[model samples]
Target: MTTKRILLYAALAAGAFISVFPYLLVVLTAFKTKAQLNSTEPWLPGVPPTLDNLGRLLGGDFPQYILNTVIMTVLLTLGQLVFTTFAAYAFARLRFRGRDVLFWLYMATMMVPSAVTMIPLFLIMRELDLVNTWYGLLAPYILGTPYGIFLMRQFFKGLPAGLEEAARIDGAGPLTVLVRILLPLCRPALGTLTIITVISSWNSFLWPLIITSGDATKVVTVAIAALKVGIGVDYNLMMAGGLIALAPMVAVFVFFQKYIVRSVVLTGLK
Candidate 1:
């Protein structure tokens, strides 16, 4: 290889290592024993690795935490898909008066950080006595977000109008066109939104932490945070929790990353 190309590859490799090394350290540390983790040795685990940390977790309530996280993520993603798609279809296709103004007004909510709304939401949930229930945990999120609606709406607006027009000519209703014709073609956009929602919902810590009490309703993120308690940290256990919390998102990104690219490409085309 040319010297310039060699330098480029070297720089890229270095940057990759910088980006990945912390996660690599977490993975390595999870497999290490308590004694090994306490030692000065920075990266490598001693002699044999151990499953004791992970085993301890899986042997107990961590699986429940995993389940809670899964339940929330799945429900949240599905709700976002249904609600965002419908709202986007309306904003994109329907010609109701004040549609643009209404959408922009709704979208303005995005400018407000979620932290600002949490107190009011909590108070409302408290007033309704919904706190700590599944409804309480999910009700705030299941309607989806302005960003998702905006993304879906932009994608919907980009499609060739002829397809929907042709479907209309065939006596297809709007819902029929949305479900059978338009949605299928929107696979890339939907997939993009699904993955985004799944990742965000899965990693959500603050809302779940604030809303949930006890082990029952706490998701994996809260569970992981619970590892570092009081004065000291249990590195072995904490690292293991970190690994467990991270795996699903990594798998999700690896699998659905293509859809993100496709959405970008398709949207850019319009």
Candidate 2:
């Protein structure tokens, strides 16, 4: 048993090293000068790495890109949380006409490839004169996604019925019960949903690239891609921007990691 434990630890360590090495390399490369970056020994930066590239990115539109990404992600996440929670509540508690069929149909959308719908979405945006605008960029995400609904439904289903029942008995309407009792108890699920929604919106590339053509509406992912060309592919500036873009996601994950894990565990428990 001791030997088996030793092997398992060794394997896990090896896996961790493999996963972390690329990011370390990227970070190291980001500190190197162009001459050093292009050199055969570019894999490692020397004793005193410079922050020149970071400075350059900070001086450019990278700051604006970061701001835009934050705004867009926050807006989209807020909309998703409200919409998904309500939809999930309805599906889990309410008895209505075609509820099951409608839910099934919504879930069916998860199976469809996003690429298949891009053209139609683009055309609709154009028709609405929302193209090249922040509203246009965020409009698609404002509608709660199928995956969000599905996740919330699962979490909502796992909730005990007693609390809601007690609230109803206390002269609480459905909305009152949801707002006062259900939602407060749903902190773990809400945290999980926020983490997922924020990450997806932050990392989104293709849709933002296709829809927003100007800086006014461009998101971090698209901005990052443009940086490659804008700075003549200056590796350090690009890396700095990449790191900046990733900071919010990392902070969010760190903050809510416990609840996110709990939510996942509970989903499986049900």
Candidate 3:
């Protein structure tokens, strides 16, 4: 091989190792005992791998945290897909008075940092008496995001108008065209949106932290933070919790990463 090509391959290999090393350390540390974790070489494999940390995690409120996270992620993702799909279809295919202006106005919200809206949203949830409920935890996200709407709209716009026109000629209404025609063809975009929404909701900490109290509504991210108690950091336990929290996201990326790449390519989303 050419020297340039060899250098490129070496650079890629170095980048991959650098990206994966921290996660590898976390996984390895999860198996270590407390003593091993406190040692200078905590990144080394445990002398004898132990399930004690995993057992304690599972036996504690962690399972509930997992369940809560799953429920919130699934519901929020589904809600976003449904809401954004309809909004995108409208924005893409349907002509309305001031449609472009309105869509642009809505999309402009994306420029606002989420942190800026958190306080107002919290107050709104509080006004509705949803402060400590799962609904409150999910309210901000269950509604579609500007980015999701934009992504779906771009994908929808790329689709041939003839598909919807043909469906309409067969007496299919707008809803029918969306459900039976557009949605089926937009699987890659849908999958991409689903993965994004799931990951975002799963990793959400600040919103859940502000809206929830105690263990009742705590998601895994918040629950994992709870692992740090007044006592010194239990590195092994913390690593174990981190692994548990990370496993689903890793599984999801492994499964849907192809769809994400395909969607980005097809939709021309950078």
Candidate 4:
């Protein structure tokens, strides 16, 4: 048993190093200057590391891209959470006409590839005169997704029915009971959702690419692509931009990752 455990620890340590090596290289490269590149020692950690790459990346239009992405991400995350929670609570507890049918119909849409709907959605946005505006960028995604509704509904179902009954006996309204009682206990699932939402919103490229024009509304992902297009052959600066773009997702995951593990463990969602 001791030998097996020792071997397991050694294997885990090796795997950790292997996974972390690329990120470490990015960090080192982010700090390097154009002069630091060597054909012989490509991965060389430069002595007296310079901040020229980072300075150039941050001291330009890149921050606007980051700011736009951040704004959209926050809006989408909050919008999904609020709307998803309300819809899930209704589906789980409220008895309404065509309830299950409506839910399943909505869920069925999730099976369809988003790409299939993109053109139609863009046409609608353009018809609404939302093109090249924040409204256009946000309109498509502000509503809760089917997957979010399903996850929340399942979690809501797994809770004891008696809890809501007890709240009702205490004269709590449906909204009150959901907000005060259920949401408190849904931290793990919500956290998991938040992490997923933030990452998805942050990395969103395709729809934003279609909706936004020029520098005004370009997101981090678009800006990164622009770096390759505009500033050809500045690898160090590009890596610096990548590091900046990567930081928020890293922070969000570090903060909310426990919820992901806990949600899987408690909710039995794969």
Candidate of highest TM-score: 3
Better of 2 and 4 by lDDT: 4
Q: Rate the local accuracy (lDDT) of all candidates.
A: 0.89, 0.83, 0.88, 0.85
Summarize candidate 4's per-residue lDDT along 1-270 as a digit string, tens digits.
Answer: 699999999999999999988887878888877778553255678887889988887889988888899899999999999999999999999999999999999999999998888899889988999888888998777779988889999889988999999999999999999999999988877976777788889999888888888788889988876677653577787788888988987786687677766755755662
Per-residue accuracy of model 2 over 1-270 as CA lDDT, tens digit each: 699999999999999999877777767876777777776375576447878877887888878888898898899999999988899899989899999999999899889999898889999999999889987788887779988888888877888999888888889998998788888888877887788788889999999999999988888889778866643667776676777776777787688788778867865664
Question: How far in Å is the alpha carbon of 209 misplaced in model 4?
Answer: 1.8
Better of 1 and 3 by lDDT: 1
**Can you write out model 3's per-residue Cα lDDT over 1-270, one digit (the tens) per residue?**
999999999999999999999999889988988787766484579778899999999998899889988888889988999998999999999999999999999999999999999999999999999998988988787879999999999889889999999999999999999999989999888888887788888999999989999677889989888889996888788889999999988997787788767766755653
Considering lDDT, where higher is better, how would the candidates rank from best to worst?
1, 3, 4, 2
What is candidate 1's CA lDDT for residue 259? 79
Candidate 2 accuracy as lDDT:
0.83
Candidate 4 Cα deviation (angstroms), residue 266: 4.7
Clashes of 1: 0
Listed in order, each prediction's TM-score against the native is 0.94, 0.92, 0.94, 0.89
Instruction: Please provide, for model 1 over 119-209, each residue's C-alpha lDDT reduced to its tens digit, 9 standing for 90 to 100.
Output: 9999999999888888999999899799899989998988999999999999999999999999999988887788778889999988898
For candidate 4, the C-alpha RMSD (Å) to the true structure equals 2.4
Which candidate achieves the best lDDT against the true structure?
1
Model 3 poorest ten-residue lDDT run: 261-270
